[model samples]
Target: MKNLDYGVIGNCRTAALVSKEGSIDWLCLPDFDSPSVFTRLLDEEKGGSFAFLVSGEYVVTQTYLGNTNILSTRFEAPEGAFTVLDYMPRYRTSEKSHYLPPEVHRYLRVLYGKPKMRILYDPKMNYAGEEAVHTVFPNYIRTSSAVDAEDKIYLYSSVNFDVILSGEEFTLTDHQFFLLSYNQKLVAIDENRVLLDYERTKVYWLNWINRSREYRQYGDMVNRSMLVLKLMSYQHSGAMLAAVTTSLPESIGETRNWDYRFCWLRDASMSIDTLLHMKHQGTAERFIGFIKRILKSREDTFQIMYGIRGERELTEEILSHLAGYENSYPVRIGNAAYNQLQNDSLGYLMDVIYKYYLYFPGTLDEVEEIWEVVRNMVRMVLKSWRSPDQSIWEFRTRELNFVFSKVMSWVALDRASLIAELLHKDNYAELWRKEANGIKEEIHEKGWNEELQCFTQAYENTDHDSSLLLMQFYDFIDARDERYVKTVKAIKENLFHNGLMYRYKAEDDFGKPTSSFTICTFWLIEALFVIGETDQAREIFESMITYSNHVGLYSEDLDFETKRQLGNFPQAYSHLAFINTATLLSEEKKLSRFIRP
Candidate 1:
């Protein structure tokens, strides 16, 4: 069964998903947004992959090296036993620079008797739009797309190129290595250099993990989620990705699939906020810098998402030729939701900026520049808070005055007011506070459903939305308030199925969602915990943890009955929620902030 049983490895430049049986299934080359080099995860026959085929007698197990991103898959059989350590080299070269590269290093170490396996090396560049011609050389094998000469990858290996290309059986009696690079290597490619790179990369991850704050409970899982988030962060532009892959269907054979390679303002902001709570300060600063760079014009309207390098126009396209994941059709590349009027994004960004003001407190000029951003966000919020638009779910068909969007618009004003007070601008703070209070009063009057005794999905409807559980999370309402407590339980009753929670049960453009949104379950757990349902919350958390793939990683959604992972792999939103909920449960106490006196 082709499941999302995969472990991700990256160097912050690019990432690859390695399946449990040792196959490089999904990988984007050179950069995260670049055309995929391996796409077998989407199309089994047409999309290409690189794998190692072993006999049926072999028992293979995969795991990540403790406290690091290096993935190790061991194969044991009566004939022999061996292990493959897969990682992308990432380590500090100097105080101000890192040696991150767009490549992967696979180190094979013999555990005992000679292991017999066949190397299956097949790569389809440019999203498998064209065939790749492989030209084998003595030291390396160069594969280039049939159409574009510039689109190429170099594979340097210690084993014979004939054995790899021909998929012939090879005997492994000693340690060997395979280095796959996007750019041709200038230095000597040998086992010794790869081994050194492996060691340094391992050490770098260990040191990075050592800096994160530890918890009394679920600490290892939190660390792993943080590492996954770090992998999705594009170091070049400081833009955080929603996921590494695109168009993995939410439900098999459903049209709910959308590309998630680019960075969403809300998703990236929430991810940075979670990392900040884990004491990873660099991500917060870098993301804020990315935001500043992209919002260069104060008049520039905020889109929900942008390319990794801050490209504004993400034209959606469908790859008609390739088969989608699990035969799901319309494999997509660019996300069209970029232009949607998602009013909720500004709130998340402003929340992060508020935290940065309190914790990071950079130089005077930097502070002023960010203050300008805060003001611009306020301006946009004030202008559009009354208008109806797409909410956090990014519905493509119709626009609604989503209750969550209104709450977040209020959050934007509230946070901006706090930022103003922090800068000691009393008049500005007072003005923003008035606007925020008006938004909140409107939500209380219109967004809440008196008949249902809870908040609805949108002001005009009585449908329950999982996102409303976050009202208390953002400090919009007290957790113990009757309305919020009722809303949480109402959403749980309506959306929670079998152990996972759906974003909403209502029908949308693609009909009702069948798969559970992974993050909504986390939100439910936290809300339940806050509402004094500690036992149930803990039980649900444990169940949710068990649903994660073998490597403790989650995708965007999971099947309601089968519990199969779906949507984009290693979704940042899912992991961010995991870290936040785990940390909240670990502490058993909420961290209250008195941003407003």
Candidate 2:
């Protein structure tokens, strides 16, 4: 079965997806939201790529360098062998600032005898909307988009521009490198600068990993997931992207695709919460800064998502010129779900904020500013908690009083009460606590399906949703409660297919989901473990690890039958869930460190 056999390398400013055979198939220049400079992942024929061609007699292998984001791919043959190291430069320039440029560095080192290879350097600037003109100078090759004159990139290589541009075969006798940058270099690019940047970036990642708290088991996998999460974080604005790519379908050849390059408040807040537990307080604080910057006024409303730089209106656009991954059509950019009223979002944000007040208290001014945000979120929850709206799934066709949304609404009020009590506002705490109890009573009365013997998907229906498994996760219910146990079991029985878990079985706008929503399976695993089914949970967890792509990374979804990844590549939601569930299964029962409600 085909999988997302790709390794991601980034400097937190931008990222690239290099295929297993040493090809850069997908990349967005300058920033995560920018138009693609390379799009081979979407359209194989028209979308351009950069790859090295070797004879069929050679064997190729790919892996990351140690615990860093650097990827190394080796090609071996009887005649010769070589390794290509790929990375993006990221390091601290000062105590308070970082130096991260939008660039991709490929360092080729000859290992044995002279290796003969050909270079295929093709760049489709501006999403390949129009043809590009490639100009080869003595020192570098410049590529510019025909339609958008302002879009351009430069490639400086040591292997002679004419030889590379012409795709001529050559034998490598010495070390070489290629630097692709969004900005033209004012200083000359040379072997010394390339080696220096590579070493510095390597050291920077090593230092980052050293600072994170280590686990006894599955520590390597946790570190890898953390690095992927860090790469998705935008260094400038502190917004965490859901994924690096757009329009990768959940199921191949279907239109269950949407752009995930923007920051969803629910996803970002959950990611920050996970990082905070990993002892990465800097990322959490920066995200808090991002929140404070966006919510400038008390009257400012909350959207489910926003642009990296706080752009509010992300109008959806279809790129008809390109074919999606595996013929999935109508490649899209910008997400309409941002405007959807997802009540679950406030709970995630408030949960993180409450943790901040508890673990990382700041000056009075900072605390007061965050308190204002908490008050605003409480107002929003009070105004909207009674209405039916989109839940965590972001359903497009209809709205319902989803059980998960109601539980999260209760969470928002509960956290608000805790925060108020911590700040010495006893009256506010008492009011919100009463409100939270009222919502809980309503959920138990109407949201539970006595006939089905479990909490249903919504107040009106008896469908099972895997998201309901998070009730204990958000502290909405006790794990040992009979009702909670039955809900978890019922959802697992209905949604578990083959070895993976489906988000739900009910049909929606597109159709009933066919692929496993990866995070849902992790949720089930965590739920089972919490309910004293450790053996079943461990069995499922071990099997699920085998389903990840070649580089031990997961996407948003996976095909049940084929077990191939089938969604946005390297999704943060999937990674965070894996980290959390793996931590629970790997470590002792002292869940207080990562699971504080």
Candidate 3:
């Protein structure tokens, strides 16, 4: 299958509706927490997909409606032109600040000239791994099956139009455009009723978007990225997932596929920090509430990642039946990385809490309790900082003394010191400070390769890591320090590729080379800003933004040759890197005259 250029639509719960010219290639269900009834993006053959397309050659352009996540795509066909509006209703209440969900609705409208367009409505059940018995009606089609005999899923579409089901393929063609809706637990489909629901969704998104405090420059891009960040968030629990689909593959046709549909703790923390920095305190507050809730109910031990609803047991399994993306073998669902201990995640979690307290300045009993849990984590880091478990890369090879992990462990303690002083809980301030200093000294002395005049990834290793870029951003070291400047140059000289940066040499832990990570490039921009390379930073920032999908979304990695997005679609970390770096650039622009050229 050709790479379909598609946009995404979603209600706070679940999402669907992609176009064949490859726009959202239709999705609605109970929630983001629900299973897919139309998942063609993951497994095209067996995965069901809905699409709308014109016959002739066409030029496509898409953008969200202002600061909202409502996507509108315009297709200019040779004969005529048409526009498709897609949005998942934003669930909101006047009394509450959060969005919740039960049903998600997608509306498609034909604006301006109406071309003779064909609409295909195909729903594959069981992730293209199993077949379902289909029944048709005048207004809608119903498909039912107990694939694997686990749980039953039902699909109900609107009866305002006709449905044609041929074998596994379903088609819906009309002279004019029409709206089709589906959900597992939907009772009835009323065309007028659903349209009203769609309007409410649109209004809700618009209103929430308007609440954002606009930036001086890049306001539109930042807002759209923020909206995407919100869309990735699971509203019910406030856990932001890394991406919507999984098994997109890191290397095409390689067995490096993974499921990225779960909430990474580090990702959620970065999301919270970005939201707070943007003055979206309400969103940050909701996420903090989610974190506290999860920590309270579960045992002291927390996984690096969890399901959107805080699901603890995510058993990784391969969907062998479905053909992988670009034929990447053994498409896998669920993440095996959940079991690995990434010490950096703990520091990230605490760092956000510490940042919240610094900015908001309130009595956080939850923070206090979480700090106790965090103190134990600091102890874990203290015990294991020198030893390597899994580098932030989550490499499968043997672990090394990842300097970044130790740096983050230092962040955990340093921030814990601030929390201790702020909250007046005087148990471990001295000890934490001492440990933090020790780690900092070790990072500066042992972690730095004086011969190379830059910090190494680990002690006594010449290999460079993009993570060292964070040393200045995190305030681990002064931005103006010679070593930090030298390290920045080293990374720019070595990891830089086509004006972007890679995470490392991309070799396996055993040092086998891999592709460049998109997030790392953005990290370099942030580093540039901190080191007073404003023009260079802005240039790289603009260049990286161009690499996003046509709709301003980014995946985990980018193929340097093909310029194709690899790994999971719309990666949370990449967007987060965008948010953080953009914010820094915005702040720097405001104070440019005062700073040195």
Candidate 4:
């Protein structure tokens, strides 16, 4: 039903994965964290799908509509060619403003071809728990579940066709028109309104892309990555999802599936820093404000992740009823990592605030209200720097004093002290600065192993992890440092294989990892450049970008032997790493110089 050979289209509020066969196999209505309206990605039979399938053999090619999120897929046959235009509506405020309403929850698909096609519109409501109750009309159909009568899904067509319903199936043939609206009134098909929506979406994306400070040397690969980040960004609250879908297996047909629909503080912080580096400001400010509101409400602690609307206590559970994606078991919904004590969130938060100050410089007043929150976070880091944490990997088996966690504990204090001095709120500046140095000294002493000559995954052992390479990113240490150089070489010898990288090779709760993490590979690329291995770094960079899907999209991990994408689709962490590495490695601009103290 659904395969890896697919592309994504969304309006930020919700997204869908469309197969190259012109079928929508995965989508959730209303919001990113909502229950799937079309669950075929997880279950091929019991789950639902909307497909525009051609009967005969054809060659397929897919791409976005120039710079916009509108995806255009073309199929060529011996007799004729077919095209599908798919997009989610995002109406802008005006020709001048870059604003859109939060409730533009509609999926629009238009079919254009001379070939005879088959339409299988199988929609299961409530993630297959409730079958859709459909009432056919003259030219439209209304589908909703028995559980929710008021809310509905309306499918209105633009062409002349009659729906044939047989039991649980609805089949429509010889039609090239489409309109799929959710949580809105179904009205008559307005050609002018559709044209206007498409134009506004195109204009909005083009306007946003025009502001990118990216090097044009990389061309579409870079811009498409930028567009992917924007597409993954939730327009209502500006909480960017780590990926569009969840429960995609990491090792394939295994139980490593986890939900990634929510936002991680680390992922969002890194994304905002990259956005600022690209000279884009709105999304960055909005996401920071999202985190600020969370911290402001709670004040005592920060969680690793949260729902897009800031819902807490994400209790994860498996859907035993529905089959998993491609028969992979345990399709999980909520994320249990929300309960984890990933202290790096505070460090990355402070890092973004400092980066914001570096670029805008005049936004000190905006951050003034949150200064107390920063103070509380720094005190928290100071108190728990020595404590073991679940850390970024969210290890389920054991909690250790991860070196990455400690380094970021240092990063939190480092950025807070700088922010305090920059804003002339020098009350605790010296105190934070002194503590940051203490943490750094301790890391050099304890985190490094004498025999391995590389930074260990934790302070207790010599197991190497690529996340330690993030030391270069945090400015915890520079590449020219002898210890840092040796650490890179150690990782190369231990963890790296065939130009790909793994987070660690040690035993885990789920046995040992068998795939290369895509984000870790990007980290290695940046680390290589920092060590002045420019030629090897460039080669790795060029080779790694090819691991993306047909449309230049990446998942969370890659199969080391097969080179196939794994984990969730269109991962924000992977794309964010790509953007950050691209900007840092760009020859035209030396912006990495600005990140250091």
Candidate 5:
């Protein structure tokens, strides 16, 4: 078996991770919220996969087409070279008929010089331990199995393909091609359908790319990140997943793993802000529509997360069958944290609404119903802001007065003031502003530790937190304030590591600390830029982008030594950070003369 360096290809509904050596290591079919069909990234044995590899040592380089999610990987071996193009056909307005098929599709093509390669198609049904029967055909192999009481199988190739049961292989000469597909139901795919899929997929991606408003200096990176953020989005619901695959492990040989494939309310709101910043109003509108649906459902208390279709019942479970990636073990599915009360979520939601009002002007009546929901949430924040709850890290340890949470609580009221003024409502604008100011004063006086010269992680302790870096970005503190400058310096000295950052160090009763979060590192980059450290910010941003996989994808955490992605692959938080920070940098370059100190 060859070690794989995978890049992702997707439509808005589902995605697949294709390796440089030609392997589909991780993919969730039907939709981003669906159960896995090929999950070797979690468990190598029973977890299914489809791969094609060259016979000898080879050099590999990959990149997505400009401003689109289509991935192209080029491999150069001693014998020859070839380019593998990968993508899923996205829905288009003109081709309404195409939408009738499965919401997702994957295509592979040999686009360049002839190179001899070996292709392998072995798909394990079930999570990681169950067995299925394979029925071989002249042009395809169908493996059928049961998952959670539902019968499911995938059609492996429709064009002169061969397969091996469990452990089989085949070698190929240069310039040859093949096709493989997975679905909830098995159906015969003809050559004409396959050819149309290829054309439709390309056209869909290119058209979507054209819709993006142009950005300078970092246009290429920004466009690619935008496409990635789009792919993670669920088209039917407009809810974006946190990541495509779950339980890749935060630290190798450690158990700090959790499923991250669901849609986080907090992440969804931030995604709206990112799309709006990129001037993609249509995407922003779609996300807002999803949020409205959640509001209309109106469960007495909202969940911190939900499935792509807004399904609320997410029970967590563990799979112990297949061997884990790098032997990480105990691969997991479904997120347990869905039930936790992360108080910051409501505030984040309000922030998106407030920003939308500013970015896209609209009448108060158009969104008044949504404001009623926010009104109820504000009352809840007032009742819960003083109490201890799970912090942003979702640490299993006891909750404390997390500084970031307090900042967002202040935001909840601050944005409420904007809504009140816009709608001419006299209910709580004065009270909300007063309460917001009081929270700011309290955070300034109690949340900072003078002895440490840093804004502490929580009100009662002196430990520095990477999250405090958001203070300036949130406008809770002025970028030029001496105290703000001091906090930035303190984080650099205490929480910084190898130009990256850790959230904070707090030993649980068991004396274990969580690994560094990649999102926090990107947060530092954004903070630096806002504080007018433009050159330093740009250097750090460039260095952080280098940590992505061969095809410009990121995970939740990093394996510092091996430089491998070590969490849920292609985390939405990481991509959102890229979108926000890159937009800020691009804006600064345009306004350098006015903002330069």
Candidate 6:
């Protein structure tokens, strides 16, 4: 009965997906990649969950605690109304220590007002494959799997209630507080400590949100986007994950599930662009550090993605034991895309560096210091630009010279030339500029379809590509180019349905897509603005955000037939694209208003 239409709460170290009915359906303890303690999101029964249900009929509403990652759910029942405040502890570090080690993060639930509740607490460790042992204490209960004693949890209550040892069930007659923790080692529960823990965690998140500078016009949307990005970020290594939970399908009943818990360099680079634009310079700097620290050792090479801690070699495998989400089979954990030859990574990475240099040229140490890695990346691009590999869409079919990839290849060299010029390497800069021009010329000749009067998906193909809209955002293509106008017209003619735009209409590994990608439409909005269709751009931009869920979040795709979100929850690409498109739209609207008089 539970679904992903839920609010997410996290302390950067870990996150919990709590459904509207007050159930913690998905949570990975200790870290993002850690074994899930509650994962009913993937499977209903065997995948354990923590739920506190009202005894009688109730109307449920859910939201976050005012600009913080703390989630709250209100249950208004016939008997009475009660609210549950849920959060993972994230108190600021003590001035005494330079770094704080992972403490026992308490998932505290404080009930306000009195409502008879039934507790269903089940802990299935390691995909329900490992057996965990529970020991009862006077005021608390501690649990640790027999296989991994190092990771333990303590469950304590603020008030005693009727407890059934069978299935860890409890019956509550009144409101009370409970703490589920892996960091605290104490046996007795403390009410004052629970209250302080909640306050400290709330304050920490608010402080983090307060760090962002002014976001004018659509500040609320920007705030929500920034917070969602922050919630998906891994605190320990500063690696930004593509999404919080993985294996959510891009299409229901299809084998499109992918684990996005690891850090995709492409996604991270795109995220940095958004964060820096939103005045979250600290996050941008940290991610830059994560990349420099991770990729510095490798010579003339990069990956599509890496584990949160910069781990290489993410072997693709199936978790046959666990039933997939919606019974969609073959739940995967590690991503196989890590092995693909995604040459676009170089372009995205260089784009991030170029952004950093442009924003804080005098202060960005990473841009200047990581030149060795930068030089090697340029060399990699020059070597691999002509070869066919997995492009950004990451199709399981054979690779082609995707026009989007070629456009980004042009981006790589263009940025490399600019960076080289900034660093005063005239010869190197000129060489990259010359190479960039060649790629541009090749794209003009081969990547474009003359008869169709627009850019195509790949060389020699006439498939309508939504990614063609992206060419306008980059310098490789001018927005006013007749080819650009024809590309938009071609997509509107072939790929659009109602108000939404599909990524592509051609059948590929997954057959024809049944939904419009949220990010691609955002690209369309940006292109509309660029081509002086400001009125239509604003309308589309405003309407597209309405597709997001109740908490202003989006998945990778939304079903074209039913208008349901169909991919990973809280997708970074969609949100980042939203921020970018919204900002541009707002700016254009202001300009239009100013010029009207």
TM-score of 5: 0.89
Candidate scoring better on TM-score of 2 and 4? 2
Candidate 5, residue 132: Cα displacement in angstroms equals 2.7
Model 3 per-residue lDDT tens digits across residues 1-597? 244345556654565545435444324345553456666666666777656545667777776666566677777765666666666556556667534444434444444454555555565555655565555555444565546433334334442334334323222232222344343434455556566666677777777677876778777777777877877877678788887777777767777788877888888888877777667787777777777777764345777889888888888888777778777777777788888867688778877878767666446676666666666666666777777767788776557788888888888888877777777767777778888999888888788887899998877478999988888666688788999999999999999987766788746744444566888988888778777888898998887877777777778888766667788766778887887777778766442211110
What TM-score does prediction 2 earn? 0.98
The residue ranges of model 1 lying beyond 4 angstroms of the native Cα positions read 591-597
Worst-scoring 10-residue span by lDDT in model 4: 101-110
CA-only RMSD, every prediction: 1.1, 1.2, 4.0, 3.0, 3.8, 3.8
**Model 5, C-alpha of 202: deviation from truth (Å):** 2.1
* Better structure of 4 and 5 per TM-score: 4
| Candidate lDDT (C-alpha), each | 0.91, 0.91, 0.69, 0.78, 0.70, 0.76
Q: Is candidate 2 or candidate 5 better by TM-score?
A: 2
lDDT of the structure predicted as candidate 4: 0.78
Measured with C-alpha atoms, the lDDT of residue 353 in candidate 6 is 79
| Candidate 2 residue 26 C-alpha distance from true site, Å | 0.5
* Model 3 RMSD, rounded to 1 decimal: 4.0
Give each model a TM-score: 0.99, 0.98, 0.89, 0.93, 0.89, 0.92
TM-score of 1: 0.99
Model 6 lDDT per residue over 1-597, tens place: 323587777766777787878888887777888778787888887887777756557788887778887777887765667678887777666742222223333233424444565677777777665666778877677778879887677677764523523533343445467777656644345767767777887787788778775556777777778888987777667799898877888777888889888899888988987788667876777787787778656562688899999998888788887888898777888888888887677788888777766666545565566677678888889999999877888887769988889889999999888878778889999999999999999989998887888888888578888887878676666678888877877877788787788888888887888777878888888877877787888888777877777777778888776677777877888889888877776555332110100
In model 1, which residue pairs have backbone atoms overlapping below 3 Å? none
What stretches of model 4 exceed 4 Å from their correct place? Answer: 1-3, 94-113, 164-175, 361-365, 588-597
